[model samples]
Target: MERTSPPLRTVARAFEVIELLWELNGATLAEVTRRMDLPKSTVHDYLRTLEMVGYITRIGETYQLSYRFLTTGGRLRNRSRFFQTARPVVRRLADETGEVASIGVEEDGECVILHAMRGEKSLELGIYPGLRVPLHAHATGKVLLAHLPEAYAEETIFSDGLAAVTDHTITDVNRMKRELSAIREQGYAADWDEQILGMGTVSVPIVIEDDLVGSISVSGPTGRVEDDDYRAELLKGVREAANTIMVGYQYGH
Candidate 1:
């Protein structure tokens, strides 16, 4: 095996604190220390440095991320050809399905929602652009995982520890391997109350020029998705949206 060095501990710690803050929206020193299992002094040093650098803001004993992160996301979204191409496709899928449709890509061992559209009947599920989700937790996530090289996929799962959000989440490695294989064979993936208790998603990979770019999904309440005819319509719409994105991307490029 080729040896690879780990990231510098200081840099990693900084990012760990940042991620904790993102997850919590804002955190007190004690909250961060308790959640991340880091020393208070260490957390304090990182928080001070981050706040001093204008990457975070401290207000009334709570530390929150600066708006710079949103600005960064907007800049990156503008530059992303995939995001540009997939945006309208997501909108159309939402319109057709009366659910929320999204396009997402793999980043740093997680799936990040790049764009999302909500239909008139869509329930606000709290999903949004720039939201990062686990690779083994949702439909888009499974699609992302199914498309990666086996070694890379396994590495992501091993490194992330398959953190379970619900009782239905797949936590066993061997079982997850089998699930990924099934997703690959099926060409699309479904989430039935795995990530959240009531939501369901059906996703298809957005492939461009024979390469997997990302996944498109139509997600809504499980009741709507459980209807057999409605499920069929949702799957068809999602797949068509993926095809449209691929065509638009190939043509525009």
Candidate 2:
């Protein structure tokens, strides 16, 4: 990579330490030094800088990220056009279905729940923001994958492999590929105990101007979600909600 200005190695190292802390959740100075392959004194200096900035906190010798990151993340989410615009539709879905209504987007090829509207009953199910699900294992993920360029999708899926979370999770690449194709053709995706057992989810992609912006899903216990007529009714609502969100997104754009 070419740089117009010289890159600051110290700043880069500081970020590397932050990422390492995030990955490990928390770590001791010794652990950070060993994991980062950096000198202990240098690692301590970096950790001290992060702590002084209030982005990291120290308890004894263990270093962990502070809740300040949450504030930053909240600001980012609050400013998002998609999150703000889709929230009304998400709330309606939750109110009408008594299920967990959520929006997910791909980050580092993993499905990250951006926000959710939960019905009273959905509190027990516990789908929330910051939840990460494998791309091959959930309805929201498959919807995003189906919209990705075919070769890129294939490479990502195959490289990641189908990590089965339940008996129903699809582990075969060929089957998954065919299913993704169907998701694209049908404009929706479904998951039956694919990520968490007894949970069924149905999702539709929110697209605007050929861009796969995000996916919206309704999740509930499989017994209620598996009923044919009920599934059909829920699907109709989901599609309408997705279409409305996309239309609003396009208009704003």
Candidate 3:
């Protein structure tokens, strides 16, 4: 039997301190000590070490995360071939559809938005890069789940147990599986206020050589996006954009 190794307490504590600072947006020495229930000296040492590494900064008495995280995240996003290839296509999709266009991928059993673009008529729904949402709750997520292996999809659904985000969100395992199967058959997936009330989304997978790369989607108010004519238009735009991204990624174009 394979045995799992215990996590290092020191490293875990250090990460805990960092997460605390992030959650509080910033914290003073006393605040960190109180929140973590650790010795003031130990918290100070951790803060000082992080500051030395340039991951955090101390301004007066408050210690906050630095721009280093942004820099690191930017570099990582740029390094992804999928993101690089999809950027222009997604932007064009937004422009053509006059709505919000986004690309997302599954990570850690959740869907992470890699990039999103706003069109002239786009509604501000607060979606941004790195935003993580449940895989069973949105069009991009459901499309990804449809394309992923059955075993992985089953594990994700059973383990996470489908927490609903809105009244329209699907919480039943069998029902969700049926929807995923329908998405596969239809080559697309849609959400009708599943993640946010009054919002609707249509998503198509970016598959290359039978392997799932990511998903592309367009979103807007449910009234506009779910209308028969407008929904057809948005679907065409997303499917074309997904095709373009796939070709660009595969051919280095």
User: Using lDDT as the measure, which candidate wins?
Assistant: 3
Better of 1 and 2 by lDDT: 2
Better of 1 and 3 by lDDT: 3
Per-candidate local distance difference test: 0.87, 0.88, 0.90
In angstroms, give how far residue 248 of model 3 lies from its true place. 1.2
Return the number of clashes found in candidate 1.
0
Task: Supply the TM-score for candidate 1.
Answer: 0.82
lDDT of 1 by residue, 133-234 (tens): 888999998998888877877666665578887998888878887888898898888877888888999999876666779999999998988787988899
RMSD of each: 3.5, 3.6, 1.9
Clashing pairs in 3: none
lDDT of 3 by residue, 61-131 (tens): 99999999999989999999999999999889988888999999998688999999999998898679999
Flag the better candidate by TM-score, 1 or 2.
Answer: 2
Total colliding residue pairs, candidate 3: 0
TM-score against native, each model:
0.82, 0.84, 0.95
